[model samples]
Target: MSSADSTDAPIYAGLVEEQGDVLAEVRRVAEEVLRDADRAIDFGGVRSSAAYR
Candidate 1:
């Protein structure tokens, strides 16, 4: 959904490129995959999900 801004850049210049890719992937998963599941867990409880078994 939302893209990272320049201010979101990592502190270590050497790791900037690598960390940026990693951060993007992590954010993508959070917004796409985990978003709904996170809400479900908060409302229904983690044990209610069959995947948690």
Candidate 2:
């Protein structure tokens, strides 16, 4: 198979979670939380974990 064909399959192919709805929830949290602070974390602005709370 070509490299392009492999891209058609899931990265977690054959895993049980890959076939369920759990990944959707994971992506949601990642986008909401991680993506939000990604910039500050990169610039060293977030100094403490408590800042998140």
Best by TM-score: 2
lDDT of 1: 0.64
For model 2, the superposed segments whose C-alpha errors exceed 4 Å read 1-20, 38-53
Candidate 2 lDDT for residue 20: 66
Q: How many pairs of residues collide in each model?
A: 0, 0
Per-candidate Cα lDDT values, in order, are 0.64, 0.69
User: Tens digits of per-residue lDDT for model 1 on 1-53?
Assistant: 24465545444454765455676778898898777886666755555786677
- Model 1 steric clash pairs: none
Query: Which lDDT tens digits does candidate 2 get at residues 1-53?
Result: 89977986665565545566667779898898977787556745455655787
Q: Model 1 segments beyond 4 Å from truth?
A: 1-13, 18-20, 35-53
